[model samples]
Target: MPSLSPSSGQSGLSGRTPPSPSEALTVYVVDDEELIRTSLQGLLRSMQLDVRTFGSAEEFLAAPKVAGPACLVLDVRLRGESGLAFQQSLAHRGLAHLPVIIMTGHGDVAMTVQAMKAGARDFLEKPFRQQEMIDAVIGALEADTRRLAAERSLDELRSCWADLTPREREVLGHVAAGRMNKQIAGDMGIAEITAKIHRGQGMRKMRSRSVADLVLKMQALDVIRRAA
Candidate 1:
């Protein structure tokens, strides 16, 4: 069966606009069948997604890396090394973050469950509906986009935290924990005014406008645990 067989009624990837260059999404298709790879590539490209096709898992791993949000569309049965095994090995290959959508002509409940458990975002049977494939690709891309964004935010937060003085960090933590300036000062054996200075400095460095904002940022950075 063809990897992507557009049903007669389906028009095209409707109502979907390509993301901005800065937020471009990519999809890598791995199917041993040249026809399947070509078909899937054409369909995904119509949506303006960056599509790459590989004949085998090794070829995919050896390909020059494209940095940014992307997902893989893998067939369960490949020429060598089954897709499920490849999915399980992704973490070791530095692709743990890559989302995968598994498709196969010889699928079963057991296969679907195995794929899902291995972190496949979606499972499709061969000759799948074009719209179904489109939806799965879109969903995978969106998930990867969110993951990249969250990682970026976390990195920025860590950089900001790294810039704070040790004293400032201590005062900020206490402040985020709802400690008053005097209490923080007493705990640190410093003057209340000194504690206030450190708190203000830390808040500015963290770009937090208030105690609540500081608390939220700290919680996101895991500098302070969330309240039970």
Candidate 2:
């Protein structure tokens, strides 16, 4: 298997329209065979895409991690690590946002079902047309873009929460849990006037003008519940 960098074999993609700056996507190919790897690399390049290829799962993982919008075209049968196992490992390492399109010459109904259940973006049998691979790559890239956007939105929500004072944070939690000002005061053992003040401060800092807005923001930030 040959290890091709992103810069090599990219000329063929000259005619293919590239995504806008805000939409550019990276497509990575991982396979154990040199021919298959290069073939996919060329195919994607011909479409004016940014493509990279790795000889094995380990090689792919060892490469510098990319945080921008991207997707993977992975083979199910690798020399050392099975594609399914690698997918699981990516999930365990918190890299599941990188959408995977699993390809195999030995695909079965059961294996395809398992791949989908494991969060694969798509599964294609070997001997697929170039167009099929291209479509899958495009779909996976779009999914990754949406996922990254959602993460950014959540991060902003967390930052908004972080700006709150301790008392405001306490009030935020109470409000998010459906507590009225009077109930929140009772729970905090504070005067209703004080509770109202804290709640208003928290709402302002969180940029939430209403109770529903506060609840939605908290849910988006994944702060409503702890993992027990």
Candidate 3:
């Protein structure tokens, strides 16, 4: 609505502690009304969030996708497209990670239920309290932060798994099975000390600090999931 104003909120958010790199969050507001978008952007920027406003859902969708903790503030009624249907369609298109908080000037019970079922994180009627909107935005950002963190951890785990040698993977499987070094050595016809070396190498490669941690990480990476 504000034509995607590009201020970094430095002026708007002076005297406030800046968010750390990892703590920075974004909010996408898609409302056709200029006044509504301007108001929402001001409020969010004051809270030190990176705010981007769109005059239409299409404009927001056209923007390059951001892979961080972000939320979409979508109005229920939009130009040509119904926001509820758009939310469902977005999920269908595999964008279930971008959480939505629906807002409307003329909301009804049916619309609220439909929005909730479509995975809308929160619903707010027009003329909503600033605190209510802030709460919803905070909740959505927290959810996205957790989701992104889990995804990053899984990706790192997979990368570590990929770095392992075949022998390391084999040793990991035995470790996950709760086999002692001597038992693993017997199963593989190797010396117990060799088995221990291989096991230690695998654990290091997996970045695991403990046997239990290694087992859970391998299970998550599916490196020894079947054994687990």
Candidate 4:
């Protein structure tokens, strides 16, 4: 196994701010070599990042899930299962959302292409510079953070959608489709004032500031679709 000790090079993480415990991020390292694991653990811990090490892919999978955003730093070669195969199996293992950084002692252009195709966030050759590893981990964490935020936003939007009454949804849909209140009332066979009331309530429930905003949210929720 290639030694990835950070002591040999300057670390860029020293002056960075660490996240609080509640919002802490994690980095999982899966490598068969004990020295590599220990070195990485020490280096990341100095920066106050939560780091976990596993000897094999199976070990990491069997471990309990950690809360908050995290990324995986995986060695390409392992005793039991190669990192390439494990990376490909992440989606099947229900870890498709997890970002991965691939590292190898022996790397080739073909191997790098394969890892990228497998959705790895980065690839590093062994004996790589310490700053390179740190940069990759930081990039992966940033990407995961954006992904989690989008997921949460979608969930909240879905919850808001579920709270809407059927009539309210219909009114909102008409508005999204560019119908006026009178037109909506005609479409739903309801009074114009009733249509206006439902439109107001629906917009309030969806927390929309304007008709255009409502339309955008509706599109996001698939309440309306643009022409192909």
Show the colliding residue pairs in model 3.
Answer: none
Deviation from native of the Cα of residue 71 in model 4, angstroms: 0.4
Ranking by lDDT: 1, 4, 3, 2
**Residue 45 error, candidate 2, Å:** 2.7
lDDT of 2 by residue, 199-228 (tens): 988888888888888888887777786335
Question: Model 4 over residues 105-186: C-alpha lDDT tens digits?
Answer: 9999999999999999899998876667887887788788888888888888999999999999999989988899999999
Please, what is the whole-model Cα lDDT of each candidate in the order they appear?
0.88, 0.81, 0.83, 0.87
lDDT of 3 by residue, 173-218 (tens): 8988888999999999999999999999999988887889998887
Supply candidate 2's per-residue lDDT for 51: 86
User: Where does model 4 exceed 4 Å of error?
Assistant: 5-11, 14-22
Tens-place lDDT per residue, model 1, 1-228, is 565666675665774554454866899999899999988998889888999999999999999867788999998898779999999999898899999999999999999999999899999997788888988888888888888888998899999999999999999889988899999999999999999999888989999898888888888988888999
Q: How close is every model to the real structure, measured as TM-score?
A: 0.94, 0.76, 0.86, 0.93
lDDT-wise, the better of 2 and 3 is: 3
- Candidate achieving the largest TM-score: 1
Q: Give the Cα-based TM-score of candidate 2 against the true structure.
A: 0.76
lDDT of 3 at 12: 31
Each prediction's RMSD over C-alphas, in Å, is 1.5, 5.8, 5.2, 2.1
- Return the TM-score for candidate 3, rounded to 2 decimals: 0.86
For candidate 1, the TM-score is 0.94
Model 1 residue 147 distance off true place after TM-score fit, in angstroms: 0.4
